[model samples]
Target: MTERILDHPVLGALEPDQTVTFTFNGMTYEGRDGEPIAAALLAAGVRTLRHHEESGTPRGIYCNIGHCFECRVEVDGQQGVRACLTPVREGMVINGGGPLPAPVRDWRKNHA
Candidate 1:
């Protein structure tokens, strides 16, 4: 993939690892198996992992590590999963865009 790093300075020459097919938002994509879900998603040109629950702002991989919760996604019907810490697996179903919170909409509507 064009998004993937073919070579790294410290990591040496990058070689193709086992590829796994996973679905994101109902679209199928291929990624290196066992890599962080965040990396796989990015390599597959997926930037916005999910939207903020309250604000509805687009969220993505900010830290690339597990510290930041920006990369939250739904994995296998589970919500609030951190993609950066989770490994890519075969046939995994990931939902990057979930239903927006109704409270925000209701609050805005009522206030307006």
Candidate 2:
């Protein structure tokens, strides 16, 4: 992936924001504070978020308004988290659609 620094025509001289470090697929990446996860990933040249669970098809940020679940990712210990709606935070651990935590069964299948 190529470097994706934005050079906007209308918003000349983009100001740098407070940066926060977040891990994506075990790799550290820098993102602006309060920025959406998808925007941060796109700026870093990361197009694919995860592969379809059934077909293994690559999925990326689509309908960035949080209408579509194409940008779902695993964050910390949570599964099926929507990246487009989530803000970038310091020390966030992100996974590239890896295996999710097993579903809760019988309300206490494993807890009991």
Best by lDDT: 1
For model 1 the local lDDT of residue 26 reads 88
Model 2, span 4-99: residue lDDT tens: 455768877557778899999888998889888888888888999998664457999989999999999988979888999999899999887733
Candidate 1 lDDT over residue span 1-112, tens digit each: 5498888889988887889999998899998999999999899898999886656778899988788888988899998889999999999999976546798678876997
Instruction: Report, for every candidate in turn, its global Cα lDDT versus the true structure.
Output: 0.87, 0.82
Could you tell me which residue pairs clash in candidate 1? Answer: none
Off by over 4 Å in 2: 1-7, 98-112
> How many steric overlaps are in each model, in order?
0, 0
lDDT of 2: 0.82
Per-model C-alpha RMSD: 2.8, 5.8
lDDT of 2 at 93: 93
The best candidate by TM-score is: 1
